[model samples]
Target: MAKILIILDERTLYLYQNNQVVRSFPVAIGKASTPTPTGNFSIINKLKNPYNKALGTRWMQFTHRMHGIHGNNQPSSIGKAISNGCVRMYNKDAEFLYDRVSIGTPVEIRQNRRTDSKNKSGYSYYTVKTGDTLYQIAKKFNTTVEKIIAINPNIKNKNTIYPGQQIKIPD
Candidate 1:
Protein backbone atom coordinates (compact mmCIF):
# COMPACT_ATOMS: atom_id res chain seq x y z
CA MET A 1 0.00 0.00 0.00
CA ALA A 2 1.10 3.57 -0.74
CA LYS A 3 1.38 6.17 1.98
CA ILE A 4 1.46 9.94 1.74
CA LEU A 5 3.33 12.25 4.05
CA ILE A 6 2.81 15.99 4.01
CA ILE A 7 5.44 17.97 5.86
CA LEU A 8 3.84 21.34 6.48
CA ASP A 9 6.98 23.11 7.58
CA GLU A 10 8.91 21.98 4.53
CA ARG A 11 5.95 22.44 2.21
CA THR A 12 6.74 19.14 0.55
CA LEU A 13 4.66 16.03 0.04
CA TYR A 14 6.38 12.69 -0.08
CA LEU A 15 4.97 9.49 -1.52
CA TYR A 16 6.15 6.35 0.14
CA GLN A 17 5.94 2.74 -1.02
CA ASN A 18 7.12 -0.08 1.19
CA ASN A 19 8.93 2.39 3.44
CA GLN A 20 10.78 4.01 0.56
CA VAL A 21 10.26 7.49 -0.79
CA VAL A 22 9.01 7.13 -4.34
CA ARG A 23 8.39 10.77 -5.14
CA SER A 24 8.40 14.23 -3.64
CA PHE A 25 6.58 17.39 -4.71
CA PRO A 26 6.55 20.95 -3.52
CA VAL A 27 3.28 22.21 -2.10
CA ALA A 28 1.57 25.36 -0.91
CA ILE A 29 0.09 25.12 2.55
CA GLY A 30 -2.16 27.24 4.70
CA LYS A 31 -1.13 30.66 5.88
CA ALA A 32 -0.33 31.45 9.48
CA SER A 33 -3.79 32.75 10.32
CA THR A 34 -5.45 29.66 8.89
CA PRO A 35 -3.04 26.81 9.42
CA THR A 36 -3.55 23.44 7.78
CA PRO A 37 -4.62 20.80 10.23
CA THR A 38 -1.86 18.44 11.29
CA GLY A 39 -3.19 14.93 11.76
CA ASN A 40 -3.39 11.48 10.29
CA PHE A 41 -6.16 10.93 7.76
CA SER A 42 -7.05 8.94 4.67
CA ILE A 43 -8.13 9.99 1.25
CA ILE A 44 -11.87 9.66 1.20
CA ASN A 45 -12.63 10.62 -2.40
CA LYS A 46 -11.03 11.65 -5.67
CA LEU A 47 -12.31 14.21 -8.14
CA LYS A 48 -11.06 14.86 -11.62
CA ASN A 49 -11.22 18.44 -12.79
CA PRO A 50 -13.78 19.46 -10.27
CA TYR A 51 -16.04 22.40 -11.14
CA ASN A 52 -13.78 24.76 -9.24
CA LYS A 53 -11.13 26.01 -11.60
CA ALA A 54 -9.23 27.41 -8.68
CA LEU A 55 -8.61 23.83 -7.59
CA GLY A 56 -6.68 23.08 -10.76
CA THR A 57 -7.22 19.72 -12.49
CA ARG A 58 -7.61 17.30 -9.59
CA TRP A 59 -8.89 17.13 -6.07
CA MET A 60 -8.17 14.44 -3.50
CA GLN A 61 -10.55 14.82 -0.66
CA PHE A 62 -9.31 13.93 2.80
CA THR A 63 -11.37 12.77 5.73
CA HIS A 64 -12.37 16.38 6.26
CA ARG A 65 -14.94 17.54 3.75
CA MET A 66 -13.75 21.14 3.74
CA HIS A 67 -10.03 20.51 3.39
CA GLY A 68 -8.21 18.30 0.89
CA ILE A 69 -5.14 18.11 -1.27
CA HIS A 70 -5.89 19.72 -4.62
CA GLY A 71 -4.26 21.39 -7.58
CA ASN A 72 -4.22 25.14 -7.96
CA ASN A 73 -4.49 27.43 -10.97
CA GLN A 74 -1.73 29.64 -9.62
CA PRO A 75 1.52 27.92 -10.30
CA SER A 76 3.53 30.64 -8.61
CA SER A 77 1.88 29.80 -5.33
CA ILE A 78 3.11 26.23 -5.32
CA GLY A 79 5.82 26.93 -2.72
CA LYS A 80 4.03 29.48 -0.65
CA ALA A 81 1.78 29.36 2.35
CA ILE A 82 -1.40 31.03 1.10
CA SER A 83 -4.05 28.40 1.05
CA ASN A 84 -7.19 28.17 3.16
CA GLY A 85 -5.96 25.15 5.13
CA CYS A 86 -5.98 22.67 2.20
CA VAL A 87 -2.64 21.57 0.82
CA ARG A 88 -2.21 22.88 -2.74
CA MET A 89 0.03 21.55 -5.48
CA TYR A 90 0.79 22.37 -9.07
CA ASN A 91 -1.76 20.97 -11.51
CA LYS A 92 0.69 18.50 -13.01
CA ASP A 93 2.02 17.39 -9.66
CA ALA A 94 -1.50 17.05 -8.32
CA GLU A 95 -2.54 14.96 -11.28
CA PHE A 96 0.52 12.79 -10.93
CA LEU A 97 -0.14 12.13 -7.27
CA TYR A 98 -3.87 11.67 -7.81
CA ASP A 99 -3.29 9.07 -10.47
CA ARG A 100 -0.92 7.10 -8.29
CA VAL A 101 -2.80 7.07 -5.01
CA SER A 102 -6.28 5.74 -4.43
CA ILE A 103 -9.06 6.34 -2.01
CA GLY A 104 -8.18 5.18 1.52
CA THR A 105 -4.47 5.84 1.04
CA PRO A 106 -3.10 6.84 4.39
CA VAL A 107 -2.22 10.54 4.56
CA GLU A 108 -0.16 11.97 7.36
CA ILE A 109 0.22 15.72 7.77
CA ARG A 110 2.69 16.88 10.36
CA GLN A 111 4.82 19.87 11.31
CA ASN A 112 8.60 19.43 11.19
CA ARG A 113 10.05 22.14 13.34
CA ARG A 114 13.61 20.92 12.82
CA THR A 115 13.61 22.11 9.21
CA ASP A 116 14.01 25.63 10.52
CA SER A 117 16.80 27.70 8.95
CA LYS A 118 19.06 27.14 11.89
CA ASN A 119 21.30 24.09 11.98
CA LYS A 120 24.26 22.93 13.99
CA SER A 121 26.56 23.68 11.04
CA GLY A 122 25.38 27.29 11.01
CA TYR A 123 23.56 27.89 7.73
CA SER A 124 23.27 31.03 5.68
CA TYR A 125 20.21 32.31 3.83
CA TYR A 126 20.35 33.64 0.30
CA THR A 127 17.77 35.73 -1.49
CA VAL A 128 17.04 34.40 -4.94
CA LYS A 129 17.87 36.73 -7.80
CA THR A 130 16.66 36.73 -11.39
CA GLY A 131 17.95 33.87 -13.52
CA ASP A 132 18.96 31.91 -10.43
CA THR A 133 18.76 28.13 -10.41
CA LEU A 134 19.52 25.63 -7.70
CA TYR A 135 22.58 24.62 -9.67
CA GLN A 136 23.99 28.15 -9.60
CA ILE A 137 23.32 28.54 -5.91
CA ALA A 138 24.87 25.20 -5.09
CA LYS A 139 27.92 26.03 -7.19
CA LYS A 140 28.29 29.38 -5.50
CA PHE A 141 28.02 27.78 -2.07
CA ASN A 142 30.34 24.86 -2.85
CA THR A 143 27.50 22.41 -2.23
CA THR A 144 25.36 20.08 -4.29
CA VAL A 145 21.99 20.85 -5.84
CA GLU A 146 20.42 18.08 -3.81
CA LYS A 147 21.72 19.68 -0.64
CA ILE A 148 20.08 22.97 -1.50
CA ILE A 149 16.80 21.30 -2.31
CA ALA A 150 16.99 19.28 0.86
CA ILE A 151 17.17 22.44 2.90
CA ASN A 152 14.55 24.39 1.01
CA PRO A 153 11.63 22.08 0.41
CA ASN A 154 9.49 25.07 -0.49
CA ILE A 155 11.30 25.35 -3.78
CA LYS A 156 9.08 23.37 -6.12
CA ASN A 157 11.01 23.88 -9.34
CA LYS A 158 14.74 23.93 -8.74
CA ASN A 159 15.19 25.27 -12.23
CA THR A 160 12.59 27.98 -11.88
CA ILE A 161 13.23 30.54 -9.21
CA TYR A 162 12.02 34.13 -8.77
CA PRO A 163 13.70 37.22 -7.44
CA GLY A 164 13.23 38.01 -3.75
CA GLN A 165 12.62 34.41 -2.73
CA GLN A 166 14.82 33.28 0.13
CA ILE A 167 16.53 29.90 0.34
CA LYS A 168 18.88 28.29 2.73
CA ILE A 169 22.53 27.47 2.05
CA PRO A 170 24.45 24.85 3.98
CA ASP A 171 27.94 25.65 5.04
Candidate 2:
Protein backbone atom coordinates (compact mmCIF):
# COMPACT_ATOMS: atom_id res chain seq x y z
CA MET A 1 0.00 0.00 0.00
CA ALA A 2 1.00 3.61 -0.56
CA LYS A 3 0.87 6.41 1.98
CA ILE A 4 1.83 10.02 2.41
CA LEU A 5 3.89 10.96 5.42
CA ILE A 6 4.32 14.67 5.89
CA ILE A 7 6.75 16.00 8.44
CA LEU A 8 5.46 19.52 8.89
CA ASP A 9 8.31 20.67 11.06
CA GLU A 10 10.89 19.59 8.51
CA ARG A 11 8.98 20.99 5.56
CA THR A 12 9.07 17.70 3.69
CA LEU A 13 6.50 15.37 2.23
CA TYR A 14 7.39 11.76 1.68
CA LEU A 15 5.81 9.07 -0.37
CA TYR A 16 5.90 5.73 1.36
CA GLN A 17 5.47 2.44 -0.41
CA ASN A 18 5.23 -0.75 1.60
CA ASN A 19 6.40 0.95 4.77
CA GLN A 20 9.51 2.48 3.22
CA VAL A 21 10.14 5.99 1.98
CA VAL A 22 10.36 6.02 -1.79
CA ARG A 23 10.44 9.73 -2.54
CA SER A 24 10.40 13.06 -0.78
CA PHE A 25 9.91 16.67 -1.79
CA PRO A 26 10.43 20.00 -0.07
CA VAL A 27 7.26 21.77 0.95
CA ALA A 28 6.12 25.07 2.38
CA ILE A 29 3.97 24.65 5.42
CA GLY A 30 1.79 27.03 7.39
CA LYS A 31 3.38 30.04 9.04
CA ALA A 32 3.73 30.35 12.79
CA SER A 33 0.58 32.44 12.92
CA THR A 34 -1.40 29.83 11.02
CA PRO A 35 -0.18 26.34 11.72
CA THR A 36 -0.99 23.38 9.57
CA PRO A 37 -3.29 20.74 11.00
CA THR A 38 -1.55 17.57 12.13
CA GLY A 39 -3.13 14.16 12.33
CA ASN A 40 -4.01 11.08 10.35
CA PHE A 41 -5.87 12.02 7.21
CA SER A 42 -6.58 10.81 3.71
CA ILE A 43 -6.85 12.38 0.31
CA ILE A 44 -10.50 13.11 -0.28
CA ASN A 45 -10.48 14.95 -3.57
CA LYS A 46 -8.17 16.07 -6.33
CA LEU A 47 -8.33 18.65 -9.08
CA LYS A 48 -6.20 19.83 -11.94
CA ASN A 49 -5.55 23.49 -12.63
CA PRO A 50 -7.91 24.74 -10.00
CA TYR A 51 -9.46 28.13 -10.68
CA ASN A 52 -7.56 29.77 -7.84
CA LYS A 53 -4.13 31.17 -8.54
CA ALA A 54 -2.91 30.25 -5.10
CA LEU A 55 -3.51 26.61 -6.02
CA GLY A 56 -1.29 26.28 -9.04
CA THR A 57 -0.88 23.18 -11.18
CA ARG A 58 -2.64 20.70 -8.90
CA TRP A 59 -4.75 20.38 -5.76
CA MET A 60 -5.39 17.47 -3.45
CA GLN A 61 -7.61 18.00 -0.47
CA PHE A 62 -7.13 15.79 2.50
CA THR A 63 -9.33 15.34 5.58
CA HIS A 64 -10.20 19.02 5.52
CA ARG A 65 -11.66 20.62 2.47
CA MET A 66 -10.48 24.10 3.37
CA HIS A 67 -6.78 23.32 2.96
CA GLY A 68 -4.78 21.00 0.76
CA ILE A 69 -1.45 20.10 -0.80
CA HIS A 70 -1.08 22.28 -3.86
CA GLY A 71 1.40 24.05 -6.07
CA ASN A 72 1.77 27.82 -6.18
CA ASN A 73 3.26 30.60 -8.27
CA GLN A 74 6.00 31.31 -5.74
CA PRO A 75 8.51 28.53 -6.21
CA SER A 76 10.81 30.14 -3.69
CA SER A 77 8.38 29.35 -0.90
CA ILE A 78 8.71 25.61 -1.29
CA GLY A 79 11.13 25.21 1.59
CA LYS A 80 9.74 27.96 3.83
CA ALA A 81 6.85 28.25 6.21
CA ILE A 82 4.63 30.88 4.58
CA SER A 83 1.44 29.22 3.49
CA ASN A 84 -1.97 29.88 5.03
CA GLY A 85 -2.11 26.45 6.70
CA CYS A 86 -1.89 24.42 3.51
CA VAL A 87 1.11 22.47 2.26
CA ARG A 88 2.65 24.18 -0.76
CA MET A 89 4.94 22.48 -3.28
CA TYR A 90 6.59 23.55 -6.46
CA ASN A 91 4.30 23.14 -9.47
CA LYS A 92 6.30 20.32 -10.99
CA ASP A 93 6.69 18.48 -7.73
CA ALA A 94 3.05 18.95 -6.96
CA GLU A 95 2.14 17.49 -10.31
CA PHE A 96 4.50 14.61 -9.82
CA LEU A 97 2.96 13.75 -6.47
CA TYR A 98 -0.55 14.38 -7.68
CA ASP A 99 -0.13 12.03 -10.58
CA ARG A 100 1.16 9.22 -8.38
CA VAL A 101 -1.33 9.57 -5.54
CA SER A 102 -5.01 8.86 -5.66
CA ILE A 103 -8.06 9.67 -3.63
CA GLY A 104 -8.28 7.64 -0.40
CA THR A 105 -4.51 7.43 0.00
CA PRO A 106 -3.56 7.83 3.64
CA VAL A 107 -1.82 10.97 4.87
CA GLU A 108 -0.16 11.39 8.21
CA ILE A 109 1.04 14.83 9.29
CA ARG A 110 3.38 15.27 12.20
CA GLN A 111 5.06 18.18 13.96
CA ASN A 112 7.28 17.38 16.90
CA ARG A 113 8.52 19.95 19.39
CA ARG A 114 11.16 20.15 22.10
CA THR A 115 13.39 22.87 23.44
CA ASP A 116 16.74 23.36 25.14
CA SER A 117 17.62 26.78 26.52
CA LYS A 118 21.22 26.36 25.38
CA ASN A 119 20.36 25.52 21.80
CA LYS A 120 20.35 28.06 18.98
CA SER A 121 20.15 25.87 15.91
CA GLY A 122 16.43 26.68 15.49
CA TYR A 123 15.65 22.98 15.81
CA SER A 124 14.21 20.94 18.66
CA TYR A 125 16.49 18.95 20.91
CA TYR A 126 15.70 15.53 22.31
CA THR A 127 17.41 14.22 25.39
CA VAL A 128 17.81 10.51 24.92
CA LYS A 129 16.22 8.82 27.86
CA THR A 130 17.14 5.42 29.26
CA GLY A 131 16.30 2.55 26.92
CA ASP A 132 15.72 5.03 24.08
CA THR A 133 16.91 3.79 20.73
CA LEU A 134 17.12 5.97 17.66
CA TYR A 135 14.47 3.86 16.04
CA GLN A 136 12.16 4.26 19.00
CA ILE A 137 12.81 7.98 19.20
CA ALA A 138 12.20 8.45 15.53
CA LYS A 139 8.98 6.49 15.74
CA LYS A 140 7.96 8.41 18.83
CA PHE A 141 8.37 11.68 16.92
CA ASN A 142 6.84 10.36 13.68
CA THR A 143 10.05 11.02 11.84
CA THR A 144 12.44 8.87 9.86
CA VAL A 145 16.11 8.01 10.34
CA GLU A 146 17.09 10.01 7.27
CA LYS A 147 15.22 13.06 8.52
CA ILE A 148 16.87 12.78 11.92
CA ILE A 149 20.34 12.38 10.46
CA ALA A 150 19.84 15.31 8.11
CA ILE A 151 19.96 17.83 10.95
CA ASN A 152 22.17 16.13 13.52
CA PRO A 153 25.64 16.19 12.10
CA ASN A 154 26.82 14.74 15.38
CA ILE A 155 25.10 11.47 14.64
CA LYS A 156 27.66 10.26 12.15
CA ASN A 157 27.00 6.66 13.14
CA LYS A 158 23.46 5.55 13.82
CA ASN A 159 24.55 2.61 15.96
CA THR A 160 26.68 4.80 18.24
CA ILE A 161 23.79 6.69 19.84
CA TYR A 162 23.66 6.27 23.58
CA PRO A 163 21.42 7.25 26.48
CA GLY A 164 21.29 10.88 27.63
CA GLN A 165 22.88 12.14 24.44
CA GLN A 166 21.06 15.28 23.40
CA ILE A 167 20.46 15.32 19.67
CA LYS A 168 18.86 17.78 17.29
CA ILE A 169 15.41 16.76 16.18
CA PRO A 170 14.08 18.49 13.11
CA ASP A 171 10.76 20.08 13.83
What would the TM-scores of all predictions be?
0.65, 0.65
CA RMSD for every model? Answer: 12.6, 11.6
Of candidate 1, the 10-residue stretch with the lowest lDDT total is 110-119
lDDT, each prediction: 0.81, 0.80
Task: Summarize candidate 2's per-residue lDDT along 64-168 as a digit string, tens digits.
Answer: 547799999999888898988899999998999998889999988766433413246555666564466678778856888888888888888668687657777
* Steric clash pairs (candidate 2): 9-171
Question: What shift in Å separates residue 63 of candidate 2 from its native position after superposition?
Answer: 2.9
RMSD of 2: 11.6
What TM-score does candidate 1 reach? 0.65
After superposing candidate 1 on the true structure, give the runs of residues whose Cα lies further than 4 Å from its correct spot.
Answer: 113-171
**Which residue runs of candidate 2 sit more than 4 Å off their true CA positions?**
113-171
